[model samples]
Target chain A: MAVYTEVTDEALAEFLTHYNIGSMVAFRGIAEGVENSNYALKTTQGDFILTLYEKRVDPADLPWFLGLMEHLAAHGLSCPLPVRARDGKNLNPLAGKIAAITTFLPGVWPRRVLVEHCEPLGAALARLHLTGEGFAPKRANALGPDAWNDLLQKSAPQADSVQAGLGRELDSMLHGIVANWPRGLPSGHIHADLFPDNVFFLDGEISGLIDFYFACTDIYAYDIAICLNAWCFEKDFSFNVTKSRALLRGYMAHRALSEAETAALPVLAQGAAMRFLLTRLYDWLNTPPGAMVTPKDPLDYYRRLRFHNAAKGAAAYGL
Target chain B: MAVYTEVTDEALAEFLTHYNIGSMVAFRGIAEGVENSNYALKTTQGDFILTLYEKRVDPADLPWFLGLMEHLAAHGLSCPLPVRARDGKNLNPLAGKIAAITTFLPGVWPRRVLVEHCEPLGAALARLHLTGEGFAPKRANALGPDAWNDLLQKSAPQADSVQAGLGRELDSMLHGIVANWPRGLPSGHIHADLFPDNVFFLDGEISGLIDFYFACTDIYAYDIAICLNAWCFEKDFSFNVTKSRALLRGYMAHRALSEAETAALPVLAQGAAMRFLLTRLYDWLNTPPGAMVTPKDPLDYYRRLRFHNAAKGAAAYGL
Candidate 1:
């Protein structure tokens, strides 16, 4: 529900003139992503998405994100294609903000995680990683292992406010996870935040993958681990092994995981849980009481982290 | 930017099954209109708007509003057409709330009012009033002059907090306007809230009129007075007589105003301004500081009230 910048009709009319897409038929700010201002723009040409990169996005990373989408789309992946303007560039300026238009993808993201949804989601994710090959621009995972300690240090003082002894417990867990972080395990482009809300499904099939702002270069299996935590957990914080087994089998069918990759799932899943927990904890402690967007409960991720910590090995994940 | 009720994907799919409007191709929550939850829904048939009536709207009035829109569209006025389901009824239930689908109208509302916009807007308002003749249902204006005094009494204690002496000044002005209120000047159904945002234009012509929640049975001249304050005023609170002239002239080209209606513009305009000021003042005082939608500044309407209070006659508005 972010529309930080308002584009006046007069300004919008002038802006569309520079594009080959037919004149604007309808345009509206969409309440979808949080980091950027998005509008569902319709023209005579077709429906498209217009995004104004807000302050949270770095203007420097614009090219890489747009280029990555192009790379994936060229390889026949179902993703949003950045609409190239008559100027031969996807990015353009409008209303004093860096804005771009993308072809509208057709599907609704699943709200409830179902067992049947796991296999198809797994295959699509693996295909995404395989298709992202040969894309030269590499964006190091910003929320990777190195950043966890810094996040922990900043949040340590007030972490107990979320849960008693959460600060010290996380400090020890962070040290262990960072020390045991794997050196290499088939790395490539990964959608770090592949939550159910980011993956769109239509008629029981994966139709589209969106919100590439968080896409970056990272361990491929780490992406799988993120999905394991996001997709396999039930509302009561219990891990569903049937969904986990299906998701893993779906991934292995597309691209087989190495013996080492399979073994690292437990630790990687723990680290993945840590990344979200730290961020959510920081937000929970910092967000103003009456803020527009309610901060998610950090304890939800903490419970997942506890499960990953107690798991003996990959078998615990039904791998 | 209101989406009070979130319609889940599973629920939405089952809900759309009742309608013959083809499968959903693309849908996104739209950040427009402050009242109901609106989604820009695109299906195989065509683009449409899905509105879930929130608690702010009375469920009993749903039929009248939908029927009025139907009547308007049936008369060849460019407005949203309520799409009927197989049951031949427009109203239906979805996600524990009443929901309906309406054919989407094409056109962008003017963000900045120009002189050229007033004439077409005037004609459209007249057409809307004239076309609404046979609609049998009658609804009283909820935010009429009668509501103004109650709102003022509720907001009086803190009115001076916004500006010195604003409470007492509004009290005396309210008495004068209420006592001098016009009666029976071409009374009919009126779109009580015809601000520029409610009127859409394309290629220098009015293409659509929307947000009929405030439409009610009232003096037609009072509707004109609302337009005078909304469309004919500059940002600095100075009246734009040029725009006002074109608006009234364009309106009368369809339906001529009687002598009494013309003479009543001064007090009527002041009353209209007071109506908005009181409501905005009440909202400003009641809404917490950090609410999602910022309450519109009551001072802006206060300035408009001051101008209307000093207006001598209809000639001052270029009538």
Candidate 2:
């Protein structure tokens, strides 16, 4: 839960004069994301989300994120449509930060992931990958394989401060992954951070997908690997085979996996686990004392990575 | 920003089964208040606020706070009405804590208070006191004059540690206030914590008053004093006479102040400042290291207390 910047009502009123959305009736800072300051805004016309991009988000990547949401919404995938201003620009400036308003979507992300949740998530994810076929903008995943070594270098010095011998273990795992990293396997736009909290559900069906800040061109199978790590694990980090079967089968119903994509699942899943592990490790080490946001335990992903390392093939994923 | 307890989707679904409000659509924890976990809940029926009372709130006083809102809303004062379930109860247990749903009020609280804000605030506050004339339930102000000595005792030891001789100054001030505290100034239900953030505005009008947890039967003049301390002070701690005059005039337009009330304004304002100073000092000293909520500077109220100490009479408050 984060609201790093406070926007005054006078400044907000002045900002709204540029838009066609009528006067602001209400606006509330939403305690949801860590990367941006978000407000639930209601106006004379309709309800929307006002997002102020914080320093953590690159200003250069703002257009890609906004454009991806617009493209996906236009292609019939449920997501926030950026509320364009009279100047035909969705992104504008407020309180010395880039800000944009988007149409409010109505659905809650599933808190306790059930088997029922995995199927629709799988189907919507496939649709997202398919609909994002020709999006004009391109964003390379900043946290992709090429970035892992630098992240590990920064986190390695103090990695064992959190756990004994953890740094050496991570170094060995990184060496193995770099040696066997998959290449040239069906690249497309992927929601690089498709965690359970980013997917919304209504009436037991997937209502929408959000937080496209991490969307970038990557191996589509890697996106699936992220979901398998996110949705198919229990609180105790135990793998749920039934849920995995449902998620994979549901995805197959929309887009069949190539044999190469199938063979790549275990390594992709391992890499996905490694990706989150390194980032979480970095955050855990760097978060200042008494920071507003709490960092997730890096060991949670370490546990997931261990599970993926032992898997034989897609068969181990219940494919 | 506080959301101490996370309510799972399954628990929320079960909690909603008791209410007539249709299936849940969306809910996000709001980053606004300090007392409880508040969520902006949307359903098929309409928008509402779902509050889960944290340990800071006394469980015994839940009914009083909820009932006061119901009473005030029913009596034509703009406020959030507690929504009763099919069981005819507004308060119920959810996630092992007491929770309730209230009708959502549509307006943003003023981020920066203006002189124009004070008049409507004064008039609405008077209306609130008038409408609360015959409220069936009565809750004593736990932070009233009687509680000041105890609060001082708890906070006094560390007071001088914060500033040289501050504890002795507070001790003398407490002695004078205890001896001269006003009585019989037309008491009624008061929104004791009417900070700018607690009042909502739309179209330059006071749309609603919220946060009734601090509402109690107290001297009506003291509530005005609290407002003077809150709304009529500039960031540099100087009094704004124009805003105070407009506020006082607006209140008189609704209900005239008696001679005794007018005479007691200076001492009452001093006590009001002392009340906040003691509590804030206690919180400042006792707040756990690395706690999420930052305690407000006790010295801010100490500055207000000094200003009120030098005030001559009602004229000092722009009467």
Candidate 3:
């Protein structure tokens, strides 16, 4: 629900002149992506998305993201491929912000997660990891375990305002999760923020995975752990074991997990839960009172972390 | 930036089963109109817009609005024609709210209105007034002269908070406007909210007019007056007589104004300015802080109102 930068028609017409992707016929600011401004664009060539990287996005990292998507789509994964201009560049300036056009993936993200959606989502995550393996450029996972301490500390002062003693619980929980974060477990580029809202589904199949701003070099199992926390939980924060099993089975169908990766599932999932909890907690405490976006409840992830902290092994996830 | 209703994929799929517009392939909430939740929908058959009526829109008035669009489009006006479902009904329940599908109009609204945009805008508006000659159903202009007093009173207490002596000025102006409001000019269905944002242009031609939720039976000249205020004013509130001349001349090309309508133009424009100023004043005073849509500055219209009040008839507008 964010369109911070307003693109004037004249500015847009001039901007489109650099591209060879036909002429702009229709464009609209879409209520998608919070990190940047996104416009669903239709040209004589095809439908696409025009993303203006806002202040929130570091312009330096865009090449890595665009290149990764190009590589993934080239390797048979369904994702947005950045359209190149006549100068053979994918990234350029539009209305004082860096912007890129990517092929529009046609599908709607599920508002309500169904059991039928989990397995296909798992498969897509695995496909992304496998296809993105050889991408030359590397991006450090900015929200990795190393960053959680600072985030939690920033959110600590007013955390209990959300719920009394909640900050203390998070302070204790984050330390344990970070220390126990499994090291040396199948690392590669992973879509670190593979939430349900970022995956589009068509006819019970995963049509495309989007919002690759969070993609980074990270543990493959950690990505799976993110999926577990994101897709396998009911609204009440109850873990749906059936969904978890289906997700894992779907993942294993592509790339069978290492024995160590399998055994470390609970800790990895705990780390994943902690990662979301800290970020959501920060947003909940800091986003301006009247902002259009309703920040996710940090406490929702807190309950998921508690479940992950109690899990026995991969068996707990029905893996 | 408003998406009040979150339509689930399951619910949408079920909803589309009643329509003959092919299966849905893509849908995204677009940041377009402020009155209703709008989604840009691409189906196998063609692209369209899905509008879910929110509480801001009176459900009882939907039939008249939808019918007007259908009638106008059928009469060769470039507008969104409501798509009838298999049951021969255009409106139906979706996600617990009434929703309808309409033809997706291509073309972007001029973000910064140019002189070239005014004449076409004027001509299209007259075409709308001319073509809507025989529309059976009539809708009252809810913000017409009779309603200005209550709106002014509601906003009066807080008006000075926005500007010194503003409340007193507006209170004094409202009475003068109400008493001198014109009796009868050419009357028909008018696009009450035909601001630049509601009109789309393609290749310097008017492609379509949209957001007819505010469409109501009113004086045709009053609608033209709205355009004079909306299109001919510079961002700094200075009236561009060159643009106004082009606009009035364009209207004259389509349907020549009667001598009475021409002489009444200044007061009609004055009434139009007051209509917007009162509503904007009310919204400015009433909209809770942190709301998504910024209430437009009431003073912008106040400045326009002052100009219109002093205008020496149609000659002042270059007619």
Candidate 4:
């Protein structure tokens, strides 16, 4: 477990006091991330996740993190709601770290999500985007292209000998993206990290969704591209057209896109490919020795990038 | 300007007592990045980057980060070399944050990269991998599919109702990758984040590389996939076959891949695609309101994913 910070049971109990979640019964580490500490807590009232903001999470961001949970929960999203404190605050300092308690949702993360699931997830994502329509918080994209550049600059010294060539290629790619970036797509709140684990299911139904730390305002089609990359590929890393169709069809079921949006899918997917490819590549090149975190394969996005390069039409995605 | 933790100059000066970089001439915030507090610093000896460890970075990982810099610098990689302190330490605590000083290289990030740059970057990357041959490290793939799933679980709750389908699709897609993950590929050190920003150049030649926080041991071909995604795409996020060939050829110049490795390119690219798609999709679905980070278009990878689905031969990439 990558428990960079330790939280005590007493500290958790004190934090839970702020939330009207009744009595706390049990608390245990979630045991899944290289960043932050999460505990699965079972309270006398119900099950909840207790997150102790670890080293990687900024204390200042806690309000947005917790408030987003409360806001989403209030807006009818089936998710863990942050428990409020006596002072009406969702965040509290504990054990010399910021902490919060959230209602534990019921359901299992599908290990074998099927095509049927894609439609609902897609629709739900669209609805989520709609719900965030009027949110007035002052935050910005936390890890956008600019941040990527900075991170790259920070680790350039260790980039081996190919740093120069890689630098040039990356610069060109970035410049190209900036030059031809799609404009006038429905820009609003987007769930930047809607992968499998964050989604929970009960008997083939999506019971809830979790995690919103990377959420920011960006293109809606970008979300669809992300789904395609995550859902459409086979284990051999080959894209599966059938899966792509399924995901797109599902997304379209709830949200109708304009012709411009539809036309942008291919290029949007390419940009999405670049985003992940850059992050993965950065992590791959900068993994510290003896760290517990695993660096993802950069090749996965490479093939996806190629596919976008060869892509000639968006109709194949049922757009 | 996302300075999660601030390091005062006094603290930096005290910390510099352990290094041979002489006295600090100047240090100021660089006014960029959503993670880490980066300052462009000038020492009595030369210009450098002083980074104050932010929320996302672990203090314990400082040594590995610094050591990797030292290792790469010794191996002829043009990157920031960590300046040792008077106490001969590469790391120091300043203003409640872990900090390090590195010799900054001179170069500008290219606005647009070309195929011509791909070859050198690829070759240099190959050489970097070769340099890692004797260095012993134990970091694994941190942001792989499994980690993606975990991140998804964390963010699913904040997904809007419309995005419900995305959650389902993502779950299914992850399961697909896990069930059908490819096999038989050479594994070694990889620069996970090879985005353009990390690479620096003088004129048209590569001068330096930076950022090693995400380096890890993974498939060598995966690195190629990452570079492809980073360098081979057009402004509209379309993959360019010509660019792909240029990148592969460049990579081949420095590291001659095995037949098995070459055979794995398409699949590796697919995996890379999925990895990026998943992360981008997740980010798209989870972007919170008013965040500084820009959400990347997920559709870009979707098209890329589709293209890989049709890829039956590796000849397209000049393998």
Model 1 regions lying over 4 Å from their true place: A152-169, A284-294, B157-166, B288-291
**Where does candidate 3 clash, by residue pair?**
none
- List interface RMSDs for the candidates, in order: 2.4, 1.5, 1.9, 23.7
Q: What lDDT score is found at residue A169 in candidate 2?
A: 97
Model 4 CAPRI quality: incorrect
Instruction: Give a tens-digit lDDT track for model 2, residues A70-93.
Output: 999998999999999999999999
Q: Can you write out model 1's per-residue Cα lDDT over A158-199, one digit (the tens) per residue?
A: 998888999999999999999999986899999899998788
Instruction: Report the Cα lDDT for residue B128, model 3.
Output: 95
Q: How well is candidate 1 docked (DockQ)?
A: 0.50
What lDDT tens digits, residue by residue, belong to model 4 across residues B1-319? 2334545444565676767776755343443444566666556675577777776666666676677778888988887888887777777777777787787665544436777677767877787788766667657777865586787675456433435465666566667655655576777777777776677655456778777777777888888887777778777867788878877777788778888777767666766777777677676766553343446766677567656656675775765
Better of 2 and 4 by DockQ: 2
Interface RMSD of 4: 23.7
DockQ (model 2, Cα): 0.65
Task: Kindly report which residue stretches of model 3 are placed more than 4 angstroms away from their true locations once superposed.
Answer: A290-292, B289-292
lDDT of 2 by residue, B1-319 (tens): 8677788888999999999999898999898898899999998998899999998899999999988889889989999999999999999999999999999998889888899999999999899899898687788999998998888898778888899999888989999987999876799889899999999998899999999889999999999999999999999999998999988888988989999998998898998899889889998899874566767889999999989999999999888
DockQ of each: 0.50, 0.65, 0.65, 0.01
Looking at model 4, what is the TM-score of chain A? 0.89
> Which candidate achieves the best lDDT against the true structure?
2
- Cα lDDT tens digits, model 1, B1-319, are 7566788788888888889999987778887887899988878899999999998799999999999999999999998999998889899999899999999988888878889899998999899999999898899988888888888999999999999999999999999999999887788899989998788777677879998988999999999999998998898888889999999998999999999999999998988889988888988889774455657888887788888878888889886
Candidate 4, number of clashes: 148
